[model samples]
Target chain A: MSDPYVKVRDLVTHYGTRQILNGVSVDVERGEIMVIMGGSGSGKSTLLRHMLGLERPTSGSIEILGREITTMSELDLYELSKKIGVAFQGGALFSSMTVGDNVMLPLQEHTKLPIDTMRIMMRMKLEVVDLAGFEGLMPSELSGGMVKRAAFARAVAMDPPLLFCDEPSAGLDPVVSRALDELILRLRDAMDMSIVVVTHELDSAFYIADRITVLDKGDILAIGTVEEVKNDSSERIQSLLNRKLREEEPDPDAYLARLTGTKL
Target chain B: MAADHETAGPARLVESLGRGTVRAVESFGYAASIFGETVKWILLGRRRGQAVRSGPIVSEMMDVGIEAIPIVTLLTFTIGVMLSIQGLDLLRPFGAEQQVGIGVALGVTREFAPLITGILVAGRSGSALAARIGFMTISEEVAALRVMGINPVRFLVAPALLAMLIMLPSLTVWADLVALIGGGLYISADLGMTMSAYVDQVLTTLEVDDVMHGIAKSAIFAVVITVIGVVEGSTVEGGAEGVGRATTSSVVKAISAIVLTDMFFVFAATR
Candidate 1:
């Protein structure tokens, strides 16, 4: 009923001359978990990067928390970023820092709190991510799952109102992935935070997503509740759900141009 | 048609040369931008709620300066001894071996000390900086900082730049003293000159301007090395092998830049 927390309208992007996202759009409501699902090269990650203002779109607009971000200045972006948390796919924790310091970085940068207070808050965030006692170790000492958990703790260090997770459960065991999904659910329900997750894991998506948006080749195939997306009669959706490869209708001219290294 | 065909090969070669010039200019522009942002952050980041952390700067000083002291001492000492030996050999025919003090003092203070220290730091600290930042770029740590509204230049480059600015000149002064001592030992021991006499020759031959010249050049070399390393590291692509390539490029570029800057300083000082 109210305005969505994030509104991306007709976003188009390009990597050099090749189009990555072509007029793709989606919306995320407050206190909702929106899972963006696609196979590799579906432009999902590019979409996430654009929403975070890491990359500017070739055209269209992105509104986050009712503010336009595409043309915002550095100072304005800093203000906006304080309320937005991002968890990169590879953890991206500062390797030079201990896990505790990494978790406390956002607070240290943005808050004027004392060192002891920051450390206490850092421990609390770590506890939430199930990494309470591992703060003294460096990120290299952590396992794959623990690294991901530490990265999550850092992202939510300031209790941001909106969280953007590139892929929370990617490359983890089923148990860890399921636990991450539960964590996502708890963050949304308990903290009242809106979340946008870009993932291709079907089980994780269905388990945590309030709504799912399916992308295929830079276009959205469907956007609806989990049940609504499942009941859709689109062949591409069916193939994606069944884990089957859909045969694409080939363009002979384009295929020939690609092979000959000349445009016709 | 004949004329066009005759000129085509030369024209293509010229076109590529022009493109390369443009690319080089663009690369310098990018480096200038990084340098400018680093200065701005160091000066104004605190007013904007982002303070450049001092812990990293102190740590960098240790890595780039304190850790480098022993090697700088050893190499400059050897250079001084070689200069003394060569000076004495040339002056011996004239029965003026004692004049070796003038040669060693003038040579070490005016040129060799700063040049040797610059090259050493380029190879040691510059390469390490390039590799460290290269890996961080590939791992998306730099991007993560940006996503958190933290300026990467402020968080990463400011510390190294400040450390180099403070350390390189200090190392040059240290190198000057060590090399002079080394050459003085030879003058006193083999040439039958008293230690105080050798010291007096060095002091009389050297001017404040000569010592200041080397220190000033060392400071310039420090900026060039730090900027080159940061630029090379941040632009690295392709992953681990890319990091290795960037580190090599950083050292090569830094060494070349240092030599060119030293030459310019010499030209200016003579004028």
Candidate 2:
């Protein structure tokens, strides 16, 4: 009944002269896990960045919690950003800070909570991510999986209603990846949060996603429930699901032009 | 073909000239933007209910200013002794070796003390700040800060700028005192002149304006170094190599900017 937590309409983005996202639109409902699946250069990450207002789109509008962010000023965007959390692919934890401090950073910045309360909350969040009692360690000391978990804890430190994760399972072992997927499910159920995950891992997407939006070359090829996406008749979708490469008709003229740096 | 070459030569020259001018303007604008944001956060971010934590600022002060005292003292002392020797050597030919006291006082207070401190801080803290921030930028920590609704400029650059502003003038004062003592001791030891006589000469030659001028230059130099370091760090590209390049550029730009600012100040004062 309520409006979607995020509404991205006909978003177009370009980097220099090249287009990244072309008229791509996506919606994420409240208390839903919407997985955005795409291969590299499919512009899934670009869309996520735009949703976070980290970059401006060439055209189209993004409304987060009913606020259009396309033209929002920096100060107003800061206000809007308070309700959202982003877990970057590389676990972007502040290297200078301890795990506990990193987790508590949002609380420290955005709230007037007492120091003791903040520390307790930080521990609880870390505990949720199965990183309890590892608060004193620097991010550099953590394993890759642990770093991603710590980053997740930091993102949800404020218990934001909306969360965006860029490639949460990337570069992790299968077991670690599965555990992270379970953690995402638990967080969503516990917090009643809306999560938008941009990932290319098919298993993780199928397992954790309430719905999947498959992107191909800056266009949405399919968006539906897991079964619907799996049964979709599009050859590209089937190819993605089967991990088969797309066969392209050769363009010898273009190939030669590229090799020779000349126009045909 | 000759006519085409003639036209292309002039066109290429004009294009490069325009590009260079554009780059220079963009760099100036970027530096000014950083400075403006830093000042805004330092002066106004707190009043608007944003807490400006003093802990980081104090820690930065210790790192940039207090921790630097030993090296600053050592180098400035050497410069002072050198000034004494050189001044005496030049004045001895005119049978005016006593004038070495005036030369040492004026030179140390007006130039050497602040200049040396500026260069040292630029090389030490500037490089570190740039590399630290650049690495953070490359690692996406800067973007993380943005997503958390914390202004990176407010959180990182403001404290650094504040630390530099407060500590640089203080360090210059320290440099001035130590340099004067070093020159005074050298003169007393070399000429068998009483320290009190050398002190009198320095006192007569030095004025409030000279000391103030050096302190002013140090403050400006502090701004230049902090701005360059923070700007380079924030705008880093590529990855680790980009961070390294940014650190190098920060130091080189800071030192160059400091010297140019000093020259401008001297020109303004003389005029």
Highest lDDT: give the candidate number: 2
Classified by CAPRI criteria, candidate 1 counts as: medium
lDDT by residue (A164-218, candidate 1, tens digit) is 9988999999998898888888878878999999999999999999999999899
Model 1 residue runs over 4 Å out of place are A248-264, B1-16
Model 1 agreement with the true structure over B1-271: per-residue lDDT tens digits: 9999889989999999999999889889999999899999999988988888899899999999999999999999999888899998899999988688998998999899999999999999999999999999999899899889888899899999999999999999999999999998987888887889999989999999999999999999999999999989989999999999999999999999999989998998999
Residue A142 miss distance in model 2 (angstroms): 0.3
lDDT of candidate 2 at residue A110, scale 0 to 100: 91
Model 2 lDDT per residue over B98-205, tens place: 889998998998899999999999999999999999999989999999999998888998889999999999999999999999999999998999999999999988
Most TM-score-accurate candidate? 2
User: What lDDT does candidate 1 reach at residue B136?
Assistant: 95
Model 1 error, position A136 (Å): 0.4
DockQ of each: 0.79, 0.85
